[model samples]
Target chain A: MAGKQLFIVTGATGGFGSAILRQINLLYGEDAVIIACGRNKPKLDDVTKGFAAGVKHISVDFAERQGLKERCQAIFDLAAGETFSAAYLYNNHGLASDVTRLAQDFDDSAEIEDYFFLNLTSFQVLTAVFLKNFSGVPHTCVNISSKCAVVAFPSMSLYCTGKAARLMLYKCLAAENPEVKVLNYSPGLMLTTMTENFHNTVAVDSTKKTFQAFKEGNLYVDTDESAKKMLGIVKEGSFTSGEQIDFHDC
Target chain B: MAGKQLFIVTGATGGFGSAILRQINLLYGEDAVIIACGRNKPKLDDVTKGFAAGVKHISVDFAERQGLKERCQAIFDLAAGETFSAAYLYNNHGLASDVTRLAQDFDDSAEIEDYFFLNLTSFQVLTAVFLKNFSGVPHTCVNISSKCAVVAFPSMSLYCTGKAARLMLYKCLAAENPEVKVLNYSPGLMLTTMTENFHNTVAVDSTKKTFQAFKEGNLYVDTDESAKKMLGIVKEGSFTSGEQIDFHDC
Candidate 1:
């Protein structure tokens, strides 16, 4: 039996992630089978609340790094002895450093590890598990890359480094596995909770400029529209494996 | 005083790192005070033994992941109440994963973390400390990058990802601090303990080909030559900040 067309959305509760999931739900309705993975219960519940059907919320904290191995195993073991196809895995979850300014970058290793944990380590662990469990399946993993991946800003050093690692990791995975497609999808500037949180918490001068841009609606894209465009790109099947596509490109 | 003209080299016992150190010793003698940092006391001793007068060996294991903060503190504390200028920091320490094949990739997170720890984490920690302690000093930090940083290969996923992170981290640092120039110097392919260890330990088909190339001298530059060329690039004052200069380019 062909197992359900599963679409795994990490950071499902986040603004961009939920937007993507909402669109997927609209597109697929009862046919939608999404594994909405996130940390917070209320936020996860909120994201999946409007879904008509085929939504499963699994609360897994990438930061704490608990239950990841068991979770991935359970994800695949349930599809044991069946032809299961994971259509897509969206590595949408990301965390910017609490210490945003480069000058004031963390001397503490634990604090710095937080950025690597969320951005690079967690994504890599998940991707490795995905590849191991579903090598036969043809699927695409869209990494929600950022401007930091390509350009290094004044204060966003941690973000840039992590996203850069994510992008290169995608490229390596793409080269290794022909069946699995990897796209480093830099979403440009979007008004997301994560981005909002950066400006709210850090209050760096550069982040202040970002806040201004958001207020002016001059720098960032509409989150919903950008999500729609991303999905549209996926649906169109135009992206080559291992290619980096920006929101404007879409 | 010129503050002893300190040049700290991590992975001092390693081929590339030692080569760089040896060249510095030959060029500057007492003028260039080299701090050869590595894990092995004997190897570090061997590397710096023949040096005439300006060599200090500091043993700090990256795998230990302990006392680094204190060690770094002690390093700069020696320069307290004295005028000092750090000329260069060679972040040359590196570690390769044992699992060479992507199909046989590490299931254990610790193994994966090890690859990242030695390659990216330790480097970043030291760099952060370096920049913090010596922000006023003009210095260059050369990361001993690999072809893996730019090009992806089968079974080298862990290395590629970690090195890519290192490259981008360097870029971020260069952008943030004008005095601290960061170079992701991909030495192309080099005959080093790490590269030799890859094929020697894990005999995958892909790595076997690399081994064959190394045996026949078909691919890779000699490690010593590459080191000299890298030093030459620094000496020439041609490199722009945040530049990725390979040995071939130099």
Candidate 2:
């Protein structure tokens, strides 16, 4: 019998995260073992309830720095001794910056450290553990990057910095490991809770105007649609591994 | 008489930092109050001693998270009650990554956190405090950025990520504040202590080969030459605000 595919998705309860999960189930059906990770147990359970493939929910708060490595290892332990044809890690977890504040307003070291620990450090550690644990498996790593990764947005310094770091991290990963398939996918402007907060709290006039246009013009990409496109790109696997492929571009 | 030109340079003991200090002295002479910051007391003293400009040394360790804001404030406090026609901050302090490690090798959360605390968080906080403390002054913020900020190099993930984040932070700062001048300058591959370490310890062959070529060909940039070009760009102020001007681009 052919081996089952392994799929690990973080932020599995968020809008794009859940959409990616649903699409994974649809695409792979019973041929995959899907490990869904999120902080809220109830939400995670809801997200993984009806998948055709085997689903395992792992509750994790990325903000909690202690025991993070062990937690990441435990994620791989879920499929211990089970052989897989391929393994995929969807690094979709991230947080939005405080849109009310500009870069100059972030003077507190502790606050800035906390923000990076959750967004950049945790993200890197998780990907590292995943790659180490699945060293022998054919691996595909996807970073849910954003337009902010390449461009600056007023009042979104933290978010843009995090995304840019994440994108560069994946690019380095791709360059170092030729056998690994790495994709930095900017899902475009999706209408999620994060965007809602950005629209409401963004202090800069120019940024607020862009969000307003996105809202009024209904230009926000549907989460499921964007997720599907990302998966399609993944399935095709023709992209240059380190290159960033955005939703609008493809 | 017109006010003095206030110049603040961090990592003042390092190759590029010292070059910048010398250039400022050459350009502004006694018209500049040059604040030189570094961790080593003797090195700071050596760098600032005998400069044509009025020089002040502030010993600071960016890695120490405690009392960071106060230290940043102390930087601006050195020029208290003194007027200036223009203010310039050369944010040159940064550490190169452990080149023996790849992106996947950075799984330890605490270790990763420590790296960013020194590189990104401290960088942002210093810039923030500088902007806030010198709000009324005509401020120019220079991020001593690198080619790694825009491209990923194997075995240099942490350094690349930090540079990328810093670049994005400055870009956001420029976007949010039109009145404040921000420059991300990529001083090309300079013969410095950091490059020496990179050459000796880099694990990736392709990256190591590039460093080898630079060494054998004597292609490394002179720190003073690059610093002068950067200062020339700053003096001209013709480049678009927030634009990344590379040493080679000019």
Query: Which residue pairs collide, candidate 2?
Result: none
lDDT of 1 by residue, A192-232 (tens): 76777776765357656767777686777877777778877
Question: What is the DockQ for all candidates, taken in turn?
Answer: 0.51, 0.92
The digit string of per-residue lDDT tens for model 1 on B126-211 reads 87777666556677788888777777666677777787788888887777677666777887677777777776765347657766
Interface RMSD of each: 2.2, 0.6
Candidate 1 wrongly placed segments (more than 4 Å) = A1-4, A49-53, A75-86, A134-136, A201-211, B1-3, B77-82, B134-136, B200-211, B214-217
Lowest-sum lDDT 10-residue window in model 2 chain B: B39-48
- Alpha-carbon error at B142 in model 2, in Å? 0.3
Off by over 4 Å in 2: none
Q: Show the lowest summed lDDT stretch of 10 residues, model 1 chain A.
A: A77-86
